[model samples]
Target: MPPKLSPSGALRFETEEHTLCGLCRTPYKSCECKGLKDNLHDWYVWHGVPSTMIPSAKDRIFVGLPPPPDNSSRTKLVKRWVSLVNISMIMGHFDANHWFSTKWESLNASMDARTKLLNEMVADYVAQLPTNTELTVLARVLGLQRRAIAGKVDGIAKEAWAALRIFLSGDWACMSKAGSKLLMNAFNTRDPKKYPRDDPHLERILDSGVSRIYGVMEMGFDKKGYCLAMEPGRRPCGVGTSTTLETSDERLISKKARKRKTTKESIPTKKRRRVES
Candidate 1:
C-alpha cells in the first residue's frame, strides 16, 4: 500500500520503503518520477509538529496528564514521571532492599547510585535558576504555571495535594502516596521553593538515597517484569518468559516444517516430449 503522507507532506509508512521516494526507489532525487522528485535535499529533512499543537510553558505546570510524546516535543511524559517518582522516593527514605532484595545487594547499591545521579540532575536544575529571581516569582512562574495556563496540566495535582495533607497529618500510611505527589509536584513546579521545606521537598532530598535505589530497580527490570513483581499472578514477567524458551524445541519445529514443505513441492509434473531428438 502507498504510505500515508503527514500534513507536512512527509510520507509516513510502516515499512522501510518510505525511507525512499515513492515514485523511485533511489535514495537520491536523480531518479525523479514526477511528484516525488522536487528538492529532494529538503525532502529528507523532517518537518516537526506544528507549533499550534505544541504545549506552551503555561500548559505544563498546574495539573493534568501531559501530551503524548512527539518528535517536536522536548519533554517526554514517561521519563518525567519516572524521574519525579524516583526523586520523591529518594527524599522519602524508602528502602532499596524492600523493592530489590529478590534481585541482589548489588542492585540495591546501584539504586543508591542512580538516586545520587538524579540528585545531581535536580541540583543542576536548581543551580540554573537565576539567583536574582524572587522565590515567589520562581514558585508561581515554574513549569506548573505554564501548564496551568495552557490547560494541559492534570487533575492529579488536587489528589496529590490531598495526599500531601494526609502525610502532614502524621500518617505514615500515606507516605508512599505523598512521596509520589512531591515528585510529581516538583516536576510541575517552576520554583522548587514552593515545595514545602519541612516535608514535601525536604522528604525528596532526604530520601534521595532510596530514590536512587528505586531508580536502579526500575532500570534493571523491563516494564512487564516490574509489573509482574508488583501484581504477581496478574501479570507475567517479561524477561523471565523470554529467557525460558528452548532452542532445541525451536530448531525441531523449524526442521519438521521445512521437510513437510519440501516433500509437498517434490510431487512430479509430466515431462515435455522432444519430437526430433
Candidate 2:
C-alpha cells in the first residue's frame, strides 16, 4: 500500500530523527529517500509515471518493488528512495573484484577535442579559397554564419564537418544531407560504397585527425597528424614558387634567343640569277 501523505507542517525533520520515513520506515540519517525532492519529475518519469501525475511513494518499477510504507508515520518519503536509485545509476557496481564504470565524461572530453581540431582544419581549408569564393562557400555550401568565419570555434567545427562531407561527394558548391548520411553509414557499417571516393584531397582529410568530420578521424593522435590544407609527399604550389619558376624560365629563354645566329642573304644569289638570264 502507498504511504500516507501528511500535511506540510507535520513533515518537518527537526523532531523526526527517531521517526522512520513513512515510505522507507528508516531513521532520518539512514533514510534511502534523501536528496530526491528536487528531482521529483525525473524520479516519477523514471518509474513510468506520467510527468503530469504525482506518483505514490510505494510505486513499483522495473528496478524493483518499493518497500512497504510505514503506517506509524505520515511523511511522504519517496524522494529519499529516488535519490538512492539515481546514485546507484551514477556509481556503477563491480562484478566480483573488477570495477566497471561508464566513461561518459571522457567521451564528451574527446568530442570537444575533435570539435576544436576540426575548427582549425576548416579555417585552413577556407583560407586557400578565393576571397569571394570563400565567402560564398561559407554562406551557401556550409551555411555558416559570418561570426562562424570569424573564429567561432564551435561554429567552425560544425561548418567544417558539413563542408568535408560535401567535398567528399565531389560537390564543393553545395552541402548534401544525402552525402553526409551515406558517409555516416559508411562509418557505421564499414562499407566502402558509402565512403568517399579515392580523391587525394578527401583522403588527406580522412587520414588527418579531424574526427568530428567523420567521428572516427583521430587527428591529434601522437601529436603528428596531417592538417587539412597540407598533405604528405606533396609540396604546396604557392605564389612564391610559381613566380620563381616563371622568372627562371624567362631568363633561360632570353639566353637561348641571344645565342641564336641570323644568317644574312648572300649577294651571290643575285649574281647567279643575272647569269641565268
Candidate 3:
C-alpha cells in the first residue's frame, strides 16, 4: 500500500538514507531521481538561471547587508543590481549634461526634486509590466536602454527605463552595510572630482569609471548608517534597530568629550625641561 499523505498533501514516505530520493521520496532501486533532477535543471535552464545561483537564506529575505557586512556574499545579488542601476543613473545624467556640484545649494535642491520625479516615473513604469512576465524577462528588460526611435519605441523605452529605476530603488531600500560601502567606494573612485584620471587599482577601477563626466556626491551613509544621499543633512539617525533615532552630532560630541576626559585622567602632564648650554 502507498504511504498516506499529510493534511497539507505532502506524501509520507519511508525514509531510508541509502535508498530514498530526498525530494520525491522514492526508493533508489526503482527511483526516477535522474528524471526529476533533470526536470529541475531543465526548468532553471529554461528560466535562464545561472548555475552558480544558490538558494538565499531566510534572513536574506529581510534585506540589507548581514550584520557585519564586511567581506560577505550572502546578499551579493541584490547589492550588485542596486550598484549597477546607481552607476547607470549617474552616467545617464552626465550623458545628458546635467552636471551639478554637490557643494551648490541650488544643485542640491534640484537633485532632490529630480529624485522625487524619477521615483514617481519609475513606479508608474513598473506597474505597466505584465503580471505574467517572468523575473528573467523583467531583469533583462530593465537592463536594456530604451530606443530613441519616435512614437512606439520611445514610449516603450521610457517605460523600460522607469521600470529599471524602480527595480533599483526597491533593492536599495534594503541596503546592507556592504552595499552602502560598495556604493560609496564606487562614487568616490569613479567621480572625476575624486580621481580626475584613470584609477590604478584594479578592484577600485572595477567600481569606478562612468565616463568623462563629473557629478555631485549627494548620497551617502553617515556613520550612524543613515542614507545621507537620499535625505541629505538629516541627523540623529537610527541604525538597524526600531528604536528612536538619535542625533549623530550628539553622539560624536559625546564621544569627543569622553575622549578628552579620558586623556586628562590617564596621561601624565609633560614637564618642560630647561636645556643647559
- The sequence of per-residue lDDT tens digits that candidate 3 reaches over residues 63-169 is 11112222222123223323323333122223222221222234323333344443443344334433323423322322222322233233333433422232232
lDDT of candidates 1 onward, in order? 0.28, 0.28, 0.28
Alpha-carbon TM-score of each model against the true structure: 0.20, 0.16, 0.19
Tens digit of lDDT per residue, candidate 1, span 165-199?
32222111112222333333344443445434454
Residue lDDT tens for model 2, 1-277 = 3333243211112222222222232332333443333335575577786644442222111111232232211112222222222222211121201210232234334434444443444455444433334343434322233544454334334444543433322221122222232233323333244333563333433433122322211210111111111011111122222222221112111234323310111213345346436
Kindly indicate the candidate among 2 and 3 with the higher TM-score.
3
Error of model 1, residue 106, in angstroms: 23
Candidate 3 wrongly placed segments (more than 4 Å): 1-107, 131-135, 139-277
Clashing residue pairs in all predictions, respectively, total 28, 6, 5
lDDT of 3: 0.28
RMSD to true structure for each model, in Å: 22.9, 35.4, 26.1
